[model samples]
Target: MALSTDHFSPSPDAAHLRARLSQAGLRATRQRLVILESLLTLPGHPTAEQVHRQVVRQEPSISLGTVYKALDSFVAAGLTRRVAAAEGTSRRYDADCTEHHHLFCTDTQEIIDYCDPQLDTLIREFFAAKGLQNFQPHSFSLHITGSKLANK
Candidate 1:
C-alpha cells in the first residue's frame, strides 16, 4: 500500500525501505512501511505510542495493535533497536542500527546519541581481557544517565 507522506516531516525513501525489508527477509506491508517510516522520520527515540499517533494521523485505518506488532517485527528484523529505560519505564525505539552509545537525561527523560572511538575500544579490550566462559561478544553500547544542563 502506498503511504501518504503528509505526516512525515522529511519524507522517507519508500524504495530504500522496501529494499531493507526485503534484505531482512521481511514482507513489505503497508503497516510495516508506515511504522518504519515513522520511526525513521521522527527525531530522537520514540515510543510505540508516539509512532502509532504519527501513523494514524496519515493512515487512520491502521490500529494501535497493528502499530505495536509492526514495531516488534521491525525489532526482530533488525531494522530498529529497542532502548530500555533505567527506571523500568516504557521502552523507546531507535532506527539507527549502527554502533553508538546513548546519553540519557533522567530529568527530562531525553536520550541523546554519543559516539566515542576510545570508549568503544576500551570496553572491547576490557571485555576481551576478561573473557566470558560461554558468551561471545557481539557489540556493546553504553547508556550514561544524567540531567542536561540548561543553556546560559
Candidate 2:
C-alpha cells in the first residue's frame, strides 16, 4: 500500500532552524543550517564524522572540517554538548541539552539516555548535605557502563 505524506510531518525547515540558531546565540548561516538539520534528524548521539557524512550528502561543498568547526561552535554556544564515548574512540555529540544521565554499553559502545527522578533527588540531597569544600558543582552526569545483554 502506498503511504500518504500527511502523516509524516515535514522536518524542521530553514526558518525554524534559523530561529533555533538565533535562540542558541549562533548565526544561522547556510552551512550552520545544514549542519543543524543533520544533527536534529540523526538518531541517538552521533560523532562528528557521522554528522559530516550526513551533511555532505545534502551539501557536497560542506567539508568534514567545516562540520568539525560548526560542531565546536555549537558546543561553545550550548547548542550541543559532547558525550564521552568508549575509551580511545572519537567523541560523540548530543543535541539534547537537558540534565540527565547515560547508560553506556561497552559491547556496542552505544550511549542510552537514562532519566530517573528518584536518582536525581538522591544525588541533589547527598550533595546538599555534604558538599565539597570550596567547590560548587554545576552539572554532572553519572554514566553507567556495562555490556548489553542479549534477549532470548
Clashing pairs counted in every model: 0, 0
Spell out the clash pairs found in candidate 2.
Answer: none
lDDT of each: 0.82, 0.83
> Model 1, stretches more than 4 Å misplaced?
1-9
lDDT of 1 by residue, 23-113 (tens): 9889999878888888888878888899999999889999989988888888998999999764547878988898888888788787788
Q: After superposition, how far is residue 23 of candidate 2 from its true place, in Å?
A: 1.1
